[model samples]
Target chain A: MDIQKVTVAGGGVLGSQIALQSAYKGFDVTIWLRSEGSIERAKPKLERLRGIYKSTLEALKTDPSAWCRGLTDSADVPAEKIDELIARVDAAADSIKLTCSYDEAFGEADLVIEAIAEVLSEKEAFYAEACPHMAERAIVCTNSSTLLPSAIVGYTDRPGKFLALHFANNIWKNNTAEVMGQPATSASAYQAVVAFARAIGMIPLELKKEQPGYLLNSMLVPFLNAAEALLANDVADVETIDKAWMLGTGAPLGPFRILDIVGLSTAYNIVAASPDAANPDTTAGKIAAKLKSYIDAGKTGVNAGEGFYKYR
Target chain B: MDIQKVTVAGGGVLGSQIALQSAYKGFDVTIWLRSEGSIERAKPKLERLRGIYKSTLEALKTDPSAWCRGLTDSADVPAEKIDELIARVDAAADSIKLTCSYDEAFGEADLVIEAIAEVLSEKEAFYAEACPHMAERAIVCTNSSTLLPSAIVGYTDRPGKFLALHFANNIWKNNTAEVMGQPATSASAYQAVVAFARAIGMIPLELKKEQPGYLLNSMLVPFLNAAEALLANDVADVETIDKAWMLGTGAPLGPFRILDIVGLSTAYNIVAASPDAANPDTTAGKIAAKLKSYIDAGKTGVNAGEGFYKYR
Candidate 1:
């Protein structure tokens, strides 16, 4: 139950972050990629994260507001201690192991986190392939944002040890890990994941039962949908909608800005999949069309340098 | 037409705020109350606002972050200039006129803001009575959060000059004025209101067309309703839901805290009015019941010193 050797199965955005965050917290972490090409792609992400962490730590030395709760325990870290923390970031960045073999990654891992693609079939195949290689005591968690844990639990060898541990993007700052478990998931396995989440400096939002979109997305998705509805229905323009919410609620970013960061394609897919999108006259249908137009023009999101608004 | 002598009908919370904010910006402001009791009720609210403005300005002198954009033009005010600003607050506080006579309040008014009761009949009655007293050039705006401008435009003397100018609570800080107009509203009137909103230190959110709930409420209501559904459906507790959002988005307050500020009675009424609330098994019905229980126990909101959480 004492999680130490952590293996993140995928070297994607979240996978690399989970590995680096674990290693940064002094855990023996390894990233399990499917091929050598994946490792090559993941290396630059880790290197970039190292620079971000070091510079952020450097900023924290003078500016207390620059303190990222996920990066360090305290905002008031002493000058010498900050240097030690920066050293730890470099050490963590250099020490994390990356490999293509599941047996090598999972055989000794006390905790194995599945952070591969979100497709259900791909996740099922991953669980089936890696089930035999994982240690008997190893607890497996999927960082799936959309899928329910119960749907994939059947593929894993130990249903009792499998659950979902979802993290928001930019885990270093927006550090919230929603730990959700299926009916079959054991109490011990759930508690262990909660403890591990805290140890890595994430606020664990424990869900009592299986909820679609978990807790964060359960609230965020609808809020975003409503904003999109306003835009699609021609009630207001993009800036007007964003400004109203920002000025009224004192929130830093508005829904459209969040959608841009979330990626327009992801938003499009979610909207398109909704039942209301079947009718061309419906608001959801209109929104899907609007998103598709932007996406067709190559304005995917902040990743593409544009979406709702342009970024420099 | 230029807006100079402004009359705010009904000296309620938002009405007093609008009147005070206008007076602070050197406008000739009058608050037309219904009776002597209303004048007495409004006097204390205006007095409290004066204290809030002075203390907030005093705090802004030392703490730059305490600057309320609605209270002043800039955060970088010189030490000596702050004394002048405080003096202006005192002068504005004493100069705001209160009256029960429609002729005295609206005969020479360039702009009349209706911030009376939300009840439709009360608003219609106020408009009918005040129409004869209002100046021929006066532009009238309703500050109703729920009722549309079009709904009450027929009762007014000049439908061409009628529109909605909505303000959020705590006008000194949360300073957004949503300007929405019906189809019959003149372009000149709309632009004048937008200019007046900016002149009073509010970021004007101009709606191109008539939309129920306007801009802020249209977006905020759905977002709050989604959070309420989650709570009603037993997906998560209030703290967990709030923590997940605040940590994930870096928002200052979560949906529940916002609900508490918005007042549970308002939330209950909105939920109860929803068509889905007819079914007891529905989420809206469940939420209505939940909010009613809190309201019945005298835990109305921050005003009542409690809602979802204790205020003081």
Candidate 2:
């Protein structure tokens, strides 16, 4: 179990954070972001994140550079640079080998974590590509919030070794994670994944049964929808609607406030498009549609300075 | 403006707190408990509340006994106490009169507040009984969570004086109130109510139009329903669910936790039976029915030591 080198797929907020944190943990990490153009666009962000990581590590009184030593920006390196990236991943291999790759980067990974797009089809395609190249026992995990674990690995040959490892935002700091078990996910795999999550400073909330959207989102959606309804009903206006939850419930921000931060459009889509919304009362369908109307009208909430309420 | 005496009705939690606070505010207060039986049952509670009120006044650097010198307990006085209650109330007339009555109590009241049961029919019946007896200039307000203002006072002769005056639970401390307006309610009445609520150390979040459940409950029901669903789905145990809101979302307690403290049976009934639950997506119907089963089985949450999860 001397896994060292690791590859991180995707360069979204979650993916990037995973890459930065993996580097911080003293792992030889490679981030396989989409394309050359994306690499160009993401370089500044990656650089800034690295700087932040450096400062964070320094503040914590730890060696900042140790984990990020062989950090390679493998977004769109030439076919030749792929070997260089692979060599860099393997060079520091006396330790654990961890890779963040979609099958293409699989040759060097003793452990692979797929932090790619959340779409089921895209995930399945990458899993298909990575399955043939993965080491026999290389542990695979998805940072999925909703997609069912069994469904994700249903097409994979080694479904027994795969599991859903859900992480909250700010992965480097947050402790809450859900270790979900699929029907095919073996007990050994569950224990190993749980141990790994714990080793990396996570408070793992294990799922006895795999359910889509897991725990948090399953609850969060209905609350968000109700906020939208408050707006639709012309009940208390936006400020009061937002303020009531804060003052009455002591919520950090009211539902509408959280909705704006999460992107009203995204929140609305999730609520309206959720497979669970078949029941009107359970889904907050009217509110979701109302939110969509607001989004469509270019009033996408705080991000655009207007939502349920105007923002400064 | 010389309010030397006051009558506080109901003598329940909200009613008792309001009465105690009114007494501490230097008004000679008479509390109108429902019946001789209720008075007997509430004797110890009133004594305890008096202690709490005294401490609260002392904390504010005020003399409780001096202000509460005229406090009267109308507990066992029977039907004969009504005249004494009215006389005491008239003696305390300082413009704002808080009560939980729907009967002849409003005849002498300058401002009659209905804080009785949350049921629409009960509240409406009380308002009907109060309006005809109310002074021509007297105002009527209901501390309702969901019922429409139009419906509450629609049958009353003086609907123009009726509106919704929502108060947070800790009435003596929380300065927030919501003034909801019915179509028949006059502008002057709305403004006066706002000013009155403000005079009593409340910040009014005024609503232009009245609707069932108003704004706050409209926004809150979804949150409660979401929590119930989470419990039903086994996302997290009750404690963890409670922690997510308190620690994660920074709410005082998660929805179910609040429901427990508030009485799971009470909350379940409100969500399930309220006219507001007529809207879709609440699942209040299902959850409420389930909670009722628990309650019937003597498994009522927190107070009963068992709910979605066990308490010590």
Tell me, by TM-score, which candidate is best.
1
User: Quality of candidate 1's docking, in CAPRI categories?
Assistant: medium
Deviation from native of the Cα of residue B228 in model 2, angstroms: 2.2
lDDT (10s digit) by residue, model 2, range B1-312: 233344445666666665555544444555544567766655566566655544443433333332221232312333344344434333333333333353445556666566677687776565566566667777767766657677677756777887878877666555468898888888888888787665555667877677565556666666677777666555556665565455345466777766766677777676676664554445545565667777888777787887655787
Please report the TM-score between candidate 2 and the true structure: 0.76
Score residue B302 of candidate 2 by CA lDDT: 81
A1-312 in candidate 2: lDDT tens per residue? 555666666667776666655554566666665566655554565556655544443333333333222232212334454444334333322222223334546666655677877798898787777678778877778887767877788757688888888877766554466788788888888887777665555666677677666666666776766666666655656777777667666567888777776778788667667664555554365566677688888888787998766787
DockQ of 2: 0.33
DockQ for every model comes to 0.68, 0.33
TM-score of chain A of 2: 0.75
Which prediction has the highest DockQ against the true structure? 1
Instruction: Give the number of the best model, judged by lDDT.
Output: 1
- Looking at candidate 1, what is the lDDT of residue B290? 82
Worst 10 residues of 1 chain B by lDDT: B243-252
State TM-scores per candidate: 0.93, 0.76
Q: List lDDT for all candidates, in order.
A: 0.91, 0.63
lDDT (C-alpha) at residue B28 in model 1: 93
Candidate 1 residue-wise lDDT, B166-276, digit = tens: 998889898999999988999999999999999999989989898888878887898898888888887789999888888766688999999999999999989998898
